[model samples]
Target: MAPKVLVVLTSQDKFPANGNPTGWYLPEFAHPYEVLKDKTELVIASPNGGEAPLDPGSAKAFENDPISAKFLKENKSLWTNTQKLADILPRVAEFDAIFYVGGHGPMYDLHSDANSLVLIQEFAEAKKPIAAVCHGPTVLIKAKSTSGEPILSGASVTGFSNTEEDQAGLSSVMPFMLEDELTRVTGGRYVKAAQPWGEKVVVSKVAGSGSTLITGQNPASATGVGKEILKALGL
Candidate 1:
Protein backbone atom coordinates (compact mmCIF):
# COMPACT_ATOMS: atom_id res chain seq x y z
CA MET A 1 0.00 0.00 0.00
CA ALA A 2 1.12 3.52 -0.67
CA PRO A 3 1.66 6.18 1.97
CA LYS A 4 -1.58 8.03 2.65
CA VAL A 5 -1.84 11.74 3.40
CA LEU A 6 -4.93 13.72 4.31
CA VAL A 7 -5.63 17.08 2.68
CA VAL A 8 -8.14 19.23 4.51
CA LEU A 9 -9.87 22.04 2.66
CA THR A 10 -12.12 24.79 3.92
CA SER A 11 -15.82 24.46 3.13
CA GLN A 12 -16.69 28.10 3.56
CA ASP A 13 -17.91 29.52 0.27
CA LYS A 14 -18.73 33.11 1.11
CA PHE A 15 -16.76 36.01 2.46
CA PRO A 16 -17.98 37.21 5.85
CA ALA A 17 -18.47 40.89 5.04
CA ASN A 18 -20.86 40.76 2.11
CA GLY A 19 -21.34 37.04 1.46
CA ASN A 20 -19.28 37.36 -1.69
CA PRO A 21 -18.19 34.00 -3.12
CA THR A 22 -14.91 32.48 -1.91
CA GLY A 23 -13.36 29.07 -1.29
CA TRP A 24 -10.07 27.24 -1.28
CA TYR A 25 -7.50 29.01 -3.40
CA LEU A 26 -6.77 26.65 -6.33
CA PRO A 27 -3.09 27.10 -7.02
CA GLU A 28 -2.41 26.57 -3.35
CA PHE A 29 -4.12 23.22 -3.70
CA ALA A 30 -2.85 22.44 -7.17
CA HIS A 31 0.88 22.84 -6.72
CA PRO A 32 0.87 20.82 -3.55
CA TYR A 33 -1.44 18.20 -4.99
CA GLU A 34 0.83 17.76 -7.96
CA VAL A 35 3.77 17.16 -5.68
CA LEU A 36 2.04 14.85 -3.20
CA LYS A 37 -0.20 12.83 -5.51
CA ASP A 38 2.78 11.30 -7.24
CA LYS A 39 4.38 10.23 -3.99
CA THR A 40 1.51 9.43 -1.67
CA GLU A 41 -2.08 8.27 -1.68
CA LEU A 42 -3.66 11.70 -1.32
CA VAL A 43 -7.14 11.95 0.22
CA ILE A 44 -9.23 15.10 0.27
CA ALA A 45 -11.34 16.08 3.27
CA SER A 46 -13.07 19.29 4.33
CA PRO A 47 -15.12 20.89 7.08
CA ASN A 48 -18.41 20.48 5.25
CA GLY A 49 -17.27 18.28 2.34
CA GLY A 50 -18.75 17.91 -1.18
CA GLU A 51 -17.51 20.21 -3.92
CA ALA A 52 -15.18 22.58 -2.18
CA PRO A 53 -15.47 25.85 -4.05
CA LEU A 54 -12.56 27.34 -5.89
CA ASP A 55 -11.89 31.02 -5.77
CA PRO A 56 -12.99 32.39 -9.15
CA GLY A 57 -9.67 34.07 -9.73
CA SER A 58 -7.86 30.88 -8.73
CA ALA A 59 -9.77 28.31 -10.78
CA LYS A 60 -7.60 28.77 -13.83
CA ALA A 61 -3.88 28.43 -14.18
CA PHE A 62 -1.40 30.26 -16.30
CA GLU A 63 -1.28 28.53 -19.68
CA ASN A 64 2.36 27.73 -19.12
CA ASP A 65 1.97 26.28 -15.64
CA PRO A 66 1.73 22.54 -16.08
CA ILE A 67 1.29 21.47 -12.47
CA SER A 68 -1.82 23.55 -11.85
CA ALA A 69 -3.27 22.48 -15.13
CA LYS A 70 -2.58 18.85 -14.25
CA PHE A 71 -4.40 19.07 -10.94
CA LEU A 72 -7.45 20.60 -12.59
CA LYS A 73 -7.51 17.90 -15.20
CA GLU A 74 -6.79 14.85 -13.03
CA ASN A 75 -8.31 15.48 -9.63
CA LYS A 76 -11.81 16.56 -10.58
CA SER A 77 -13.67 14.07 -8.35
CA LEU A 78 -11.17 14.38 -5.55
CA TRP A 79 -12.12 18.03 -5.39
CA THR A 80 -15.79 17.53 -6.14
CA ASN A 81 -16.46 14.79 -3.60
CA THR A 82 -14.32 15.85 -0.71
CA GLN A 83 -15.10 13.76 2.39
CA LYS A 84 -16.37 15.52 5.49
CA LEU A 85 -13.83 16.49 8.13
CA ALA A 86 -15.87 14.65 10.71
CA ASP A 87 -15.28 11.46 8.76
CA ILE A 88 -11.55 11.96 8.63
CA LEU A 89 -11.03 13.56 12.03
CA PRO A 90 -11.34 10.32 13.99
CA ARG A 91 -8.87 8.60 11.71
CA VAL A 92 -6.16 11.24 11.43
CA ALA A 93 -3.65 8.86 12.95
CA GLU A 94 -3.99 6.65 9.90
CA PHE A 95 -2.37 9.25 7.71
CA ASP A 96 1.36 9.78 7.45
CA ALA A 97 0.83 13.51 7.62
CA ILE A 98 -1.85 16.15 7.07
CA PHE A 99 -2.06 19.36 5.07
CA TYR A 100 -4.50 22.25 5.06
CA VAL A 101 -5.06 24.38 1.99
CA GLY A 102 -5.74 28.04 2.41
CA GLY A 103 -7.96 30.74 1.02
CA HIS A 104 -10.18 33.33 2.58
CA GLY A 105 -12.35 30.28 3.20
CA PRO A 106 -10.28 28.80 6.01
CA MET A 107 -10.63 32.01 7.97
CA TYR A 108 -14.35 31.44 8.32
CA ASP A 109 -14.60 27.70 8.81
CA LEU A 110 -11.42 25.86 9.75
CA HIS A 111 -10.33 28.65 12.07
CA SER A 112 -12.87 27.82 14.71
CA ASP A 113 -14.03 24.36 13.72
CA ALA A 114 -13.99 21.93 16.64
CA ASN A 115 -13.26 18.96 14.39
CA SER A 116 -10.37 20.72 12.69
CA LEU A 117 -8.88 21.68 16.03
CA VAL A 118 -9.09 18.10 17.18
CA LEU A 119 -7.46 16.81 14.03
CA ILE A 120 -4.69 19.35 14.48
CA GLN A 121 -4.14 18.14 18.02
CA GLU A 122 -4.16 14.49 16.98
CA PHE A 123 -1.60 15.13 14.26
CA ALA A 124 0.57 17.31 16.47
CA GLU A 125 0.51 14.96 19.45
CA ALA A 126 1.58 12.08 17.28
CA LYS A 127 4.48 14.12 15.91
CA LYS A 128 3.29 13.90 12.35
CA PRO A 129 4.16 16.56 9.86
CA ILE A 130 1.51 19.30 9.82
CA ALA A 131 1.63 21.53 6.77
CA ALA A 132 -0.52 24.54 5.93
CA VAL A 133 -0.32 27.54 3.66
CA CYS A 134 -1.68 31.06 3.34
CA HIS A 135 -4.74 31.67 5.51
CA GLY A 136 -4.84 27.99 6.41
CA PRO A 137 -2.66 28.83 9.36
CA THR A 138 -5.74 30.25 11.01
CA VAL A 139 -6.39 26.74 12.32
CA LEU A 140 -3.21 26.98 14.32
CA ILE A 141 -4.66 29.84 16.30
CA LYS A 142 -7.55 27.70 17.51
CA ALA A 143 -5.62 24.49 18.22
CA LYS A 144 -4.50 23.94 21.81
CA SER A 145 -2.57 21.23 23.59
CA THR A 146 -3.86 18.91 26.30
CA SER A 147 -2.69 21.58 28.72
CA GLY A 148 -4.81 24.18 26.92
CA GLU A 149 -1.85 25.89 25.33
CA PRO A 150 -1.68 27.28 21.83
CA ILE A 151 -0.29 24.57 19.60
CA LEU A 152 1.91 27.08 17.85
CA SER A 153 3.43 28.47 21.02
CA GLY A 154 7.12 29.26 20.56
CA ALA A 155 7.50 28.01 17.01
CA SER A 156 8.60 29.65 13.78
CA VAL A 157 5.99 29.84 11.01
CA THR A 158 4.72 32.04 8.20
CA GLY A 159 1.45 32.52 6.41
CA PHE A 160 -0.37 34.98 4.16
CA SER A 161 1.31 38.13 5.35
CA ASN A 162 -0.50 41.36 6.16
CA THR A 163 1.41 42.98 3.30
CA GLU A 164 0.24 40.30 0.90
CA GLU A 165 -3.29 40.55 2.27
CA ASP A 166 -3.22 44.30 1.58
CA GLN A 167 -1.77 43.69 -1.84
CA ALA A 168 -4.64 41.32 -2.60
CA GLY A 169 -7.05 44.17 -1.74
CA LEU A 170 -8.67 42.27 1.15
CA SER A 171 -7.01 43.78 4.18
CA SER A 172 -10.12 45.56 5.36
CA VAL A 173 -12.31 42.60 4.50
CA MET A 174 -10.49 39.89 6.49
CA PRO A 175 -11.81 39.16 9.99
CA PHE A 176 -8.48 39.56 11.77
CA MET A 177 -4.96 40.21 10.60
CA LEU A 178 -3.42 36.77 9.90
CA GLU A 179 0.15 37.86 10.40
CA ASP A 180 -0.72 39.52 13.67
CA GLU A 181 -2.54 36.44 14.91
CA LEU A 182 0.31 34.14 13.94
CA THR A 183 2.86 36.42 15.56
CA ARG A 184 0.93 36.58 18.77
CA VAL A 185 -0.12 32.92 18.82
CA THR A 186 3.40 31.61 19.23
CA GLY A 187 5.48 34.50 20.59
CA GLY A 188 8.09 33.01 18.28
CA ARG A 189 9.48 34.47 15.09
CA TYR A 190 6.92 35.15 12.35
CA VAL A 191 8.74 36.73 9.45
CA LYS A 192 7.72 37.20 5.83
CA ALA A 193 9.51 37.83 2.61
CA ALA A 194 10.97 41.30 2.25
CA GLN A 195 8.20 41.98 -0.27
CA PRO A 196 4.65 40.86 -0.80
CA TRP A 197 3.89 37.92 -3.13
CA GLY A 198 7.39 36.59 -2.85
CA GLU A 199 7.78 32.83 -2.41
CA LYS A 200 8.63 31.98 1.21
CA VAL A 201 8.57 28.68 3.09
CA VAL A 202 9.42 27.92 6.69
CA VAL A 203 10.04 24.53 8.34
CA SER A 204 9.54 24.81 12.07
CA LYS A 205 9.12 22.52 15.06
CA VAL A 206 6.51 22.59 17.79
CA ALA A 207 7.82 23.90 21.10
CA GLY A 208 7.32 20.70 23.09
CA SER A 209 5.94 18.14 20.68
CA GLY A 210 8.37 16.53 18.30
CA SER A 211 6.12 17.39 15.36
CA THR A 212 7.43 19.58 12.58
CA LEU A 213 5.46 22.15 10.62
CA ILE A 214 6.04 23.27 7.09
CA THR A 215 4.30 26.54 6.17
CA GLY A 216 4.35 28.57 2.98
CA GLN A 217 3.81 32.30 2.71
CA ASN A 218 1.38 32.43 -0.19
CA PRO A 219 0.20 30.77 -3.36
CA ALA A 220 3.51 31.40 -5.02
CA SER A 221 5.08 29.46 -2.21
CA ALA A 222 2.91 26.39 -2.70
CA THR A 223 5.31 24.20 -4.60
CA GLY A 224 8.11 25.09 -2.25
CA VAL A 225 5.91 24.12 0.66
CA GLY A 226 5.17 20.77 -0.98
CA LYS A 227 8.82 20.08 -1.52
CA GLU A 228 9.54 20.81 2.11
CA ILE A 229 6.80 18.44 3.20
CA LEU A 230 8.29 15.65 1.10
CA LYS A 231 11.65 16.28 2.69
CA ALA A 232 10.12 16.24 6.14
CA LEU A 233 8.42 12.94 5.37
CA GLY A 234 11.65 11.45 4.01
CA LEU A 235 10.00 10.83 0.67
Candidate 2:
Protein backbone atom coordinates (compact mmCIF):
# COMPACT_ATOMS: atom_id res chain seq x y z
CA MET A 1 0.00 0.00 0.00
CA ALA A 2 1.17 3.49 -0.66
CA PRO A 3 2.21 5.37 2.46
CA LYS A 4 -0.44 7.81 3.60
CA VAL A 5 0.48 11.28 4.88
CA LEU A 6 -1.68 13.99 6.46
CA VAL A 7 -0.84 17.49 5.29
CA VAL A 8 -2.24 20.09 7.68
CA LEU A 9 -2.73 23.78 6.96
CA THR A 10 -3.99 26.64 9.08
CA SER A 11 -7.56 27.87 8.72
CA GLN A 12 -6.83 31.36 9.97
CA ASP A 13 -7.44 33.82 7.17
CA LYS A 14 -6.41 36.92 9.10
CA PHE A 15 -4.19 38.02 11.95
CA PRO A 16 -6.11 38.75 15.12
CA ALA A 17 -4.23 41.91 15.92
CA ASN A 18 -4.97 43.82 12.75
CA GLY A 19 -7.09 41.64 10.53
CA ASN A 20 -4.23 41.37 8.11
CA PRO A 21 -4.78 38.42 5.84
CA THR A 22 -2.66 35.41 6.68
CA GLY A 23 -2.86 31.74 6.04
CA TRP A 24 -0.58 28.91 4.93
CA TYR A 25 2.47 30.17 3.09
CA LEU A 26 2.29 29.21 -0.54
CA PRO A 27 5.78 27.78 -1.03
CA GLU A 28 5.82 26.09 2.33
CA PHE A 29 2.90 23.89 1.33
CA ALA A 30 3.45 23.97 -2.39
CA HIS A 31 7.12 22.95 -2.31
CA PRO A 32 6.57 20.08 0.07
CA TYR A 33 3.39 19.01 -1.70
CA GLU A 34 5.31 18.92 -4.93
CA VAL A 35 7.93 16.65 -3.42
CA LEU A 36 5.54 14.23 -1.71
CA LYS A 37 2.40 14.19 -3.83
CA ASP A 38 3.73 11.62 -6.29
CA LYS A 39 5.23 9.38 -3.61
CA THR A 40 2.43 9.16 -1.07
CA GLU A 41 -1.28 9.50 -0.50
CA LEU A 42 -1.81 12.98 0.95
CA VAL A 43 -4.91 14.07 2.84
CA ILE A 44 -5.16 17.84 3.02
CA ALA A 45 -6.69 19.08 6.26
CA SER A 46 -7.25 22.26 8.28
CA PRO A 47 -8.56 23.20 11.71
CA ASN A 48 -11.94 24.36 10.42
CA GLY A 49 -12.29 22.09 7.31
CA GLY A 50 -12.82 24.24 4.26
CA GLU A 51 -11.18 27.18 2.51
CA ALA A 52 -7.62 27.14 3.74
CA PRO A 53 -6.54 30.67 2.93
CA LEU A 54 -3.26 31.57 1.29
CA ASP A 55 -1.02 34.37 2.49
CA PRO A 56 -1.13 36.95 -0.27
CA GLY A 57 2.42 37.98 0.56
CA SER A 58 3.72 34.48 0.06
CA ALA A 59 1.77 34.10 -3.13
CA LYS A 60 3.32 37.23 -4.52
CA ALA A 61 6.77 36.59 -3.14
CA PHE A 62 6.95 33.14 -4.68
CA GLU A 63 4.88 33.82 -7.78
CA ASN A 64 7.85 32.92 -9.94
CA ASP A 65 8.57 29.62 -8.22
CA PRO A 66 7.36 27.15 -10.80
CA ILE A 67 6.36 24.46 -8.34
CA SER A 68 4.40 26.87 -6.17
CA ALA A 69 2.86 28.58 -9.15
CA LYS A 70 1.75 25.33 -10.69
CA PHE A 71 0.31 24.13 -7.42
CA LEU A 72 -1.74 27.33 -7.04
CA LYS A 73 -3.01 27.09 -10.59
CA GLU A 74 -4.03 23.44 -10.47
CA ASN A 75 -4.56 22.47 -6.83
CA LYS A 76 -6.75 25.24 -5.45
CA SER A 77 -9.51 22.80 -4.60
CA LEU A 78 -7.22 20.65 -2.47
CA TRP A 79 -6.71 23.45 0.04
CA THR A 80 -10.08 25.05 -0.43
CA ASN A 81 -11.83 21.83 0.45
CA THR A 82 -9.63 20.52 3.23
CA GLN A 83 -10.99 18.06 5.75
CA LYS A 84 -11.54 19.25 9.28
CA LEU A 85 -8.79 18.45 11.75
CA ALA A 86 -11.25 17.18 14.33
CA ASP A 87 -12.83 14.82 11.83
CA ILE A 88 -9.48 13.31 10.84
CA LEU A 89 -8.46 12.66 14.46
CA PRO A 90 -10.61 9.53 14.64
CA ARG A 91 -8.63 7.94 11.83
CA VAL A 92 -5.16 9.26 12.51
CA ALA A 93 -3.84 5.73 12.60
CA GLU A 94 -4.36 5.36 8.87
CA PHE A 95 -1.57 7.82 8.21
CA ASP A 96 2.12 7.01 8.26
CA ALA A 97 3.08 10.62 8.89
CA ILE A 98 1.70 14.12 9.67
CA PHE A 99 3.03 17.32 8.15
CA TYR A 100 2.20 20.90 9.18
CA VAL A 101 2.62 23.58 6.56
CA GLY A 102 3.63 26.97 7.93
CA GLY A 103 2.67 30.60 7.63
CA HIS A 104 1.89 33.38 10.06
CA GLY A 105 -1.55 31.83 10.34
CA PRO A 106 -0.45 28.81 12.37
CA MET A 107 0.92 31.09 15.06
CA TYR A 108 -2.60 32.27 15.80
CA ASP A 109 -4.47 28.98 15.41
CA LEU A 110 -2.73 25.60 15.35
CA HIS A 111 -0.22 26.64 18.02
CA SER A 112 -2.80 26.35 20.73
CA ASP A 113 -5.51 24.33 19.03
CA ALA A 114 -6.66 21.44 21.22
CA ASN A 115 -7.37 19.09 18.34
CA SER A 116 -3.96 19.77 16.88
CA LEU A 117 -2.30 18.89 20.16
CA VAL A 118 -4.21 15.64 20.29
CA LEU A 119 -3.32 14.79 16.72
CA ILE A 120 0.36 15.45 17.35
CA GLN A 121 0.23 13.29 20.45
CA GLU A 122 -1.46 10.47 18.59
CA PHE A 123 1.18 10.48 15.87
CA ALA A 124 3.97 10.69 18.43
CA GLU A 125 2.68 7.80 20.49
CA ALA A 126 2.34 5.72 17.35
CA LYS A 127 5.95 6.46 16.48
CA LYS A 128 4.98 7.98 13.16
CA PRO A 129 6.97 10.66 11.40
CA ILE A 130 5.93 14.25 12.27
CA ALA A 131 7.15 17.07 10.12
CA ALA A 132 6.77 20.86 10.00
CA VAL A 133 8.46 23.84 8.43
CA CYS A 134 8.71 27.58 9.12
CA HIS A 135 5.96 28.64 11.50
CA GLY A 136 4.40 25.22 11.06
CA PRO A 137 6.45 24.19 14.07
CA THR A 138 4.30 26.60 16.03
CA VAL A 139 1.89 23.72 16.53
CA LEU A 140 4.57 21.92 18.47
CA ILE A 141 4.59 24.67 21.08
CA LYS A 142 1.74 23.21 23.09
CA ALA A 143 1.84 19.58 21.95
CA LYS A 144 2.67 17.13 24.69
CA SER A 145 3.79 13.53 24.82
CA THR A 146 2.15 10.63 26.63
CA SER A 147 4.22 11.59 29.65
CA GLY A 148 2.94 15.19 29.57
CA GLU A 149 6.24 16.64 28.53
CA PRO A 150 6.46 19.08 25.67
CA ILE A 151 6.80 17.00 22.51
CA LEU A 152 9.77 19.05 21.46
CA SER A 153 11.55 19.00 24.79
CA GLY A 154 15.20 18.24 24.13
CA ALA A 155 14.50 17.47 20.47
CA SER A 156 16.72 19.17 17.93
CA VAL A 157 14.53 21.34 15.70
CA THR A 158 14.43 24.48 13.58
CA GLY A 159 11.78 26.91 12.44
CA PHE A 160 11.17 30.49 11.28
CA SER A 161 13.74 32.41 13.30
CA ASN A 162 13.33 35.61 15.33
CA THR A 163 15.47 37.47 12.87
CA GLU A 164 13.32 36.33 10.01
CA GLU A 165 10.20 37.43 11.85
CA ASP A 166 11.67 40.82 12.62
CA GLN A 167 12.77 41.14 9.03
CA ALA A 168 9.25 40.49 7.95
CA GLY A 169 8.21 43.43 10.22
CA LEU A 170 5.52 41.52 12.07
CA SER A 171 7.46 40.49 15.12
CA SER A 172 5.46 42.72 17.43
CA VAL A 173 2.20 41.24 16.23
CA MET A 174 3.23 37.60 16.61
CA PRO A 175 1.91 36.08 19.79
CA PHE A 176 5.32 34.72 20.59
CA MET A 177 8.60 34.47 18.81
CA LEU A 178 8.84 30.99 17.29
CA GLU A 179 12.60 30.64 17.73
CA ASP A 180 12.45 31.65 21.38
CA GLU A 181 9.59 29.33 22.20
CA LEU A 182 11.20 26.45 20.37
CA THR A 183 14.50 27.05 22.08
CA ARG A 184 12.81 27.13 25.46
CA VAL A 185 10.81 23.96 24.86
CA THR A 186 13.77 22.12 23.35
CA GLY A 187 16.06 23.13 26.20
CA GLY A 188 18.35 25.04 23.87
CA ARG A 189 18.48 22.06 21.52
CA TYR A 190 16.96 24.23 18.80
CA VAL A 191 19.34 24.79 15.91
CA LYS A 192 19.32 26.96 12.80
CA ALA A 193 21.37 27.87 9.77
CA ALA A 194 24.25 30.33 10.00
CA GLN A 195 22.23 33.08 8.32
CA PRO A 196 18.65 34.24 8.61
CA TRP A 197 16.32 32.78 6.00
CA GLY A 198 18.94 30.24 5.08
CA GLU A 199 17.69 26.72 4.56
CA LYS A 200 18.15 24.41 7.55
CA VAL A 201 16.57 21.06 8.23
CA VAL A 202 16.74 19.15 11.50
CA VAL A 203 15.64 15.59 12.11
CA SER A 204 15.46 14.16 15.61
CA LYS A 205 13.90 11.16 17.32
CA VAL A 206 11.34 11.80 20.03
CA ALA A 207 12.91 10.78 23.34
CA GLY A 208 10.44 8.15 24.50
CA SER A 209 8.36 7.20 21.45
CA GLY A 210 11.20 7.35 18.93
CA SER A 211 8.84 9.13 16.52
CA THR A 212 10.75 11.23 14.05
CA LEU A 213 10.37 15.03 14.43
CA ILE A 214 11.51 16.80 11.32
CA THR A 215 11.66 20.60 10.94
CA GLY A 216 12.92 23.22 8.55
CA GLN A 217 14.00 26.82 9.25
CA ASN A 218 12.16 28.79 6.59
CA PRO A 219 10.32 28.58 3.33
CA ALA A 220 13.68 27.97 1.68
CA SER A 221 13.85 24.68 3.54
CA ALA A 222 10.38 23.34 2.80
CA THR A 223 11.51 21.03 0.03
CA GLY A 224 14.26 19.66 2.25
CA VAL A 225 11.73 18.97 5.02
CA GLY A 226 9.58 16.93 2.61
CA LYS A 227 12.59 14.97 1.39
CA GLU A 228 13.56 14.24 4.99
CA ILE A 229 10.04 12.99 5.69
CA LEU A 230 10.39 10.51 2.82
CA LYS A 231 13.76 9.47 4.17
CA ALA A 232 12.30 8.91 7.62
CA LEU A 233 9.59 6.75 6.08
CA GLY A 234 12.26 4.89 4.12
CA LEU A 235 10.61 5.77 0.82
lDDT by candidate, in order shown:
0.86, 0.93
Off by over 4 Å in 2: none
TM-score of each: 0.96, 0.98
Task: Name the regions of candidate 1 deviating beyond 4 angstroms.
Answer: 60-64
Residue-level lDDT of model 1, residues 203-224, one tens digit each, is 9987578798888889999999
* Candidates' RMSD to native: 1.4, 0.7
* Model 2 TM: 0.98
State each candidate's clash count: 0, 0
Q: Which candidate is the best by lDDT?
A: 2
- Predicted candidate 2 versus true structure: per-residue lDDT over 1-235, tens digit per residue: 8799999999999989899899999999999888898899999999999889999999999989999999989999989899999999899989999999999999998999999999999999999999999999999988999899889887999999999999999998898899999999899998999999899999998767899999999999999999999998899
